[model samples]
Target: MNLIGKKIKIRNFDENDLGQFLELVQDKNNHKLAGLEYTNDIEFGRDLLDMYRRRDGSYTVALQDNNKMIGIIELNKRGESTELLLTREIGFVIDKKFRNQGYAKEAVQLMLEYGFNDLQLTEVWASTEKDNLAPQKLLERLEFKYIYEADQTLPYTGQHNLVKYYLLKK
Candidate 1:
């Protein structure tokens, strides 16, 4: 699947995306802010993509002009039955170099549309580190309602971060 926007596009991960994907994960500073990581081995990167494809939830955000990947985004189903199935958790991270220039915002808008329209979701939720004002402002700008704040162990990173949660309903 591919999502096109004025400045960026979101698409399924391809083997060719490995180079840019590695750059994003291997950069220590970037993953520290994002709260995730991967090993430096090239083979490990390919293996991880295979796992991502099995779930078909993770995707790449790239420039429309050059098709160069600049970020990753995902929507993880929160539950499996009845009303719970319509809710999902969303997350994303743009390469540090491409941040603050509106790409992340556009990518998120596209995802929100997909979640509410294509997926028929009732709500999409997100949590950002309490100190990360950029995403908090973006979530508010997009009309997500504040839920609460708490200390949560990031599943992938295992880091305990003070998190502020928000949700957008369809």
Candidate 2:
């Protein structure tokens, strides 16, 4: 799964991405904000391998110039059922060092194209914590209409609920 954007490339996960994947998931701030549990490199690597084998809808986001692993983006299914394929949830996490560089936006645009064009998806949705402005802005910039906000505690943050955003194929 290789997706080329203007500045970022969404590629399949591999062993070579282990080091950077650990670094991204290890950050206390990043993990907490993204609702990810803290884990050591070994556990993280194992989880990555397991998810890759599953191959539901995961991709490694990297820089195109040097092919450096910087983040991850995924289009997840609403349920385990294969029948529900057209509607997926988009999720992403950018490296702290790479934030504010427009990488996340570019990566998302590429994924949106893949979802609507290649996958023939009818709609795509994303949820962000109330306090998370970056993703909200990204979704808005991409013309994803505001759906609604749900009140549910985040296990990792335990502070705020989530706001869902939606976009239809155009």
Candidate 3:
């Protein structure tokens, strides 16, 4: 799926995108915040390709006018069920150079539409660290309700404590 925005476009992740995707995932700051690191680009690329092959989730690339991969957005169902009550979670990561350009918000908005419309999800959820106020505020700007907080130990760093947010389709 391709979603066009005013300044960027969100589309399905392609095999050719592996290079940029690997670079983005390897960034220290991005990996620190996201709690995952890719030590082997080829292995990670294979896993991503497998996700695409299964059609179980969506991986979208945010592109600029010249078609640079500045960010990525993803939506995954909680389980195999198609029930409306089953939640879908959304996530995004923007290139450090492209920060504060509203690309994350724009890509997230388009993903939300796809999640609610095409995926038929009744609710969508997202989470961020307590210190990551940017995403929390963005979720609010998107009208996601402040659900609650939880203790989530980072899988990579073993850090605990995280705040989760949720939004229900009206």
Best by lDDT: 1
Ranking according to TM-score, highest score first: 1, 2, 3
Candidate 3 regions exceeding 4 Å error are 40-55, 81-86, 154-161
Clashes of each: 0, 0, 0
TM-score attained by model 1? 0.89
Give the runs in model 1 whose Cα sits over 4 Å from its true position: 153-159
- The positional error of residue 106 in candidate 1, measured at the CA in angstroms, is 0.5
Candidate 2 lDDT over residue span 71-129, tens digit each: 98889887756656678988899989999999999999999999889989888888887
Q: Summarize candidate 1's per-residue lDDT along 1-170 as a digit string, tens digits.
A: 79999999999877777888888878886655566565688788778767765665788899999999899899988877887898999988898889999998999999999999998999999988788888889889999999999988769897787889999999
- Reference-based lDDT, each prediction: 0.86, 0.81, 0.73
**1 versus 2: better lDDT goes to:** 1
- lDDT string, candidate 3, 1-170, tens digits: 67888878887677677667667767877765754354456787668555654564555556657667777777866666557345788877888788898888888888888777776677888877677878888989999988888887768998776657566554
Task: Quote model 2's TM-score.
Answer: 0.86
Q: Estimate each model's TM-score.
A: 0.89, 0.86, 0.80
Q: Is candidate 1 or candidate 3 better by lDDT?
A: 1
